[model samples]
Target chain A: MVKVVRNVVCPFCGTLCDDLEILVEDNHIVGTRHACRIGNAKFMHFEGAVRYTEPLMRENKKDDFKKVDYETAIEETARLLTEAALPLIYGWSATECHAHMYGVELAELVGAVIDNTASV
Target chain B: MQDVGYPVCTLGEVKNRADVVIYWGSNPMHAHPRHMSRYSVFARGFFRERGREDRTLIVVDPRETDSAKLADIHLQVEPHKDYELISAMRAVLKGFELQTDKVAGVPADLIYEAVEICKNAQFGQLYFAMGVTMTRGKHRNIDNAISLVIDLNAYTKFGLMPMRGHYNVNGFNQVLTWVTGYPFGVDFSRGYPRYNPGETTANDLLQRGETDMMLNIASDPGAHFPQKAVQHMAKIPLVCIDPHETPTTQLANIIIPPAIAGVEVEGTAYRMDGVPIQLRKVIDPPEGVLPDREILKMLIKKVKEML
Candidate 1:
C-alpha cells in the first residue's frame, strides 16, 4: 500500500516548501505532489545508484575507498581531527539545525574553524 | 547592512500586501521555480485579491532571463553595475535629476518611471540573489540596495530580502548566532567562538592553506568553491558526511553517508525569510544509514574521548 504523506518539507533549496505530498510504497518514494521540478527530483531520486549507503575510507588521496563500519570510520575521523593542528568544519546549509549544533560542538572540542556556505 | 540598517519583512507580508515587486539581479523563474506562484506574484492574499494583476513586477538583470520576460518592466542593467543602478534609484527617489542620460545601461526615463512606480506603491518588495551578491561589488551592492529601500520608505512602505540558496543556510546562521554569537566564519581555536570574516572565513582559510583537515557536512565545496580552495581541499584530509555522492565526497578520505534530511529524517529547517518550519520524514533511510545529527553526535563523542 502506498502511504501518502502530506505537508512534507522539501530538502532542496532555501524556499523550504512544506506543503508537498509524498507517496511512499514499501519504504520507497513513489511520487510527490505540489513540489517543483527540483524538489520533486530531490524526493524521487534520493535512492538512486549515485547515493552512498555505507561508510567508506581511503588512506591516500589517489587510492580507491574501501567499505568500512561506522565505528572504524568515526574512530579514524576523530584520530585525524585530534592529530591535526588546524581543522576546518564547513558545509551546514543542507542539513537540519540539530546537526548544526553537533557540528558546532565538535568544532569547539577540536578548536576547529567552523563555517557555512554563506562565506562563498 | 550594518551601517544603514535593512528594512525587511516576512514573505507572508510580501504575499499579502506587496503591490510593487522588484527582482534585481535574481532569476527566480529558474532558481526558485515556485517562488512567484506560491509567494510573490500569483499567490492570492488578504489584500492582494487580484494576485498578479494587483502587483507590478520589475526585473533588473544584465541578461533577459525568463523572470525578466515576465516582468511588467525589465531594466536591462549593465554587468557589475548594480551599485550604480541602485545609487541612481536612490538619487531619483530623493527628487534629484541624473547627470547622465543613462545609468547602468538603463535609460534615465525608465529609472524615473520605475522610481515613480515604487514611490507610489502601498507596499514594495525588492528580492535579490547571486546576481548582485556574487558580482564585482558584492556586499556593497546589497548595502546600496538596502539604502534604496530605506529611501523608498520616505515615500512609501518598502522591504528587501535576499533570495537565499540552500534549504537550511539561514538556519545555520540563526543557530550559530544564538549559540556562539556569530553567524559564520566562527573560530573556536581559543576555546571560545570568535568571528572575523576575511581572516577566518572558509574560502579565505582554505585558499591560504591554513587548515590541515576539513570536516564537511551537507554542502559540496568541491563543486562550488574556487579552484585554489578546491586544490587545497584536495591536498588535505577530508571527512565528508552527506547522503548523495557529490564532488566533495569524491575528494574525501572518509565518506560517511547520512540519511537525507527532510526525507528520511525529520528535523527543523529555516526558510529563506527566516521562518522556521518542521521537515517531515516520508520514508525510511537505507539499512544502517544514520541522519546527519546522529552521525555528527557520534563523531563529537568519539572526538571528545580522543581529546
Candidate 2:
C-alpha cells in the first residue's frame, strides 16, 4: 500500500515549495503532487538513480575509486588535509545549517579557504 | 551594496499586497516553476483577491521566455544592457526626458509608461536573477535597479529581491554572516576569518592553483566551474561529500555519500525572502547513510586529532 506524506518540502530549488504530497510504497517514493517538474523528478527518480552508497577512495587521479569503510575514508581525508599547506572547503549551498557549522569548524582547524556557490 | 541596502519584504507580503510585479532578467517559469502561482503573479491573497486579474505582471528579458508569455507587459531589453535600461527607468522616474528614441532596445515612451505603472502601484516588487548578476555590468545592474526602486518609493511602496537559485543558498549566506561576520569566500589561513571575494573565493583559488586540497560538499563545481578551475580541482586531492554521483564526484579523490537533506534529514532552510522554513524528513536514507552534519562532524574530529 502507498502511504501519503503531505506538506513535504522540496529540496531542489530555492523556492522550497513545502506543500507537496509524496506517495511512498515499500519505503521508496513513487510520486509527488503539487510539485514542479524538477521537484517531481527529484522525488521520483532519486531512489532509482545511480547513487554513491558507500565511501570511495582513489590513490591517484587515473585509478578507479575503491570502496572503503567510513573510518578509512575519514582518516585518509584528514591525513590529506593535515599534510597540505593549503586546502579549500567549498559547496555548502545544498545542505543545511548544521553541516555548515561543522564545515566552518573543519576549515578553521585545517586553516583552509572556505566558500559557497554564491562566489560563482 | 550591503552598506547601501535596498527596501525589501517577505514573499508573504508580496503575495498579499503586490499590485505591480516586475521580473527583471529572471524567467521564473523555467528556473522557479511555482514562483508565479505560489507568490508573485497568480497567488490569491488578502488584498489580491482576484489573483492574476488584480496584479500587473511585467517581464524584462532579452528573449521571450515562457514567463514573458504571461506578462501584461514584456520589455524585451537588449542583451547585457540591463544597466542602461535601469538607468533610463530611474531617469524617467526622476521626471527627466531622454533625448534618444530608445534605450537598451526598449522605447523611451514604453519605459515612461512602465515607470508610471510602478509609481502608481499600491505595492510593487522587482525581482532579478542570474541574468542581472552574471551580465557584463554585474553588481552595477542590481545597484541601479535598487536605486530605481528607491526612487519609486518616493511616490509609492516598492521592494526588490534576488531570485536565489539553490534551496539553501540564502540560508548558507544567513548562517555564515551570523557566524563569520561576512558571507562567502572566507579564509581561515591566519587563524582568523577573513573575507576577500576575488582573492579567497573558490574559483580564484582553484584557477590560481593556490589551494593544494579541497573538501567539496553538496555542490558540483566540476560541472559548473570554469575549465581552468575544474582542471585545477582535478589535479588536487579533492574530497566530496554528497548524496548522489556528480561530475565533481567523478573527479574527487574521495567520495562520501550522505543522506539527502530535506528528504532523509530534516533541517532549517531559508527561503528566497530570508524566511526560515523547516525542511521535513519523509523517509529514511539508505542504511548506514548519514546526513552532511554527521559526516562533517566525523571529518572535523578526525582532522582535529591528526593536527
lDDT of each: 0.91, 0.90
Q: Write the per-residue lDDT of candidate 1 for residues A1-120, one digit (tens) a residue.
A: 998998889988887887999998999889999999988998887545399899999999899999999999999999999998989999999999999998888999999999999877
B-chain TM-score, every candidate?
0.97, 0.97
Q: Which pairs of residues collide in candidate 1?
A: none
* Residue pairs that clash (backbone atoms under 3 angstroms), model 2: none
iRMS values in order, in angstroms? 0.8, 0.9
* TM-score of chain A in every predicted structure: 0.95, 0.94
* Number of residue pairs clashing in candidate 1, backbone atoms closer than 3 angstroms, sequence gap of 3 or more or interchain: 0
Q: Write the per-residue lDDT of candidate 1 for residues B1-307, one digit (tens) a residue.
A: 4557777699999999999999988898888888998889988988999999999999999999999999999999999999999999999889899999999999999999999999999999999998998888888888899988988888899999888789999999989998998889999998989888778899999999999999998999999999999999999999999887889999999999999889999999999899999998888899999999988888888988988
**Shift in Å, residue B20, candidate 1:** 0.9
Question: Model 2: how many Å of interface RMSD?
Answer: 0.9
lDDT of 2 by residue, B1-307 (tens): 5645768799999999999999998999999999999999999989999999999999999999999999988999999999999999988888899999999999888888898899999999999898888888877788788888888889999999989888988888888888898888899999999998789999999999999999899899999998999999999899999878888998989999999998889998989899889998888999998889988888888988888
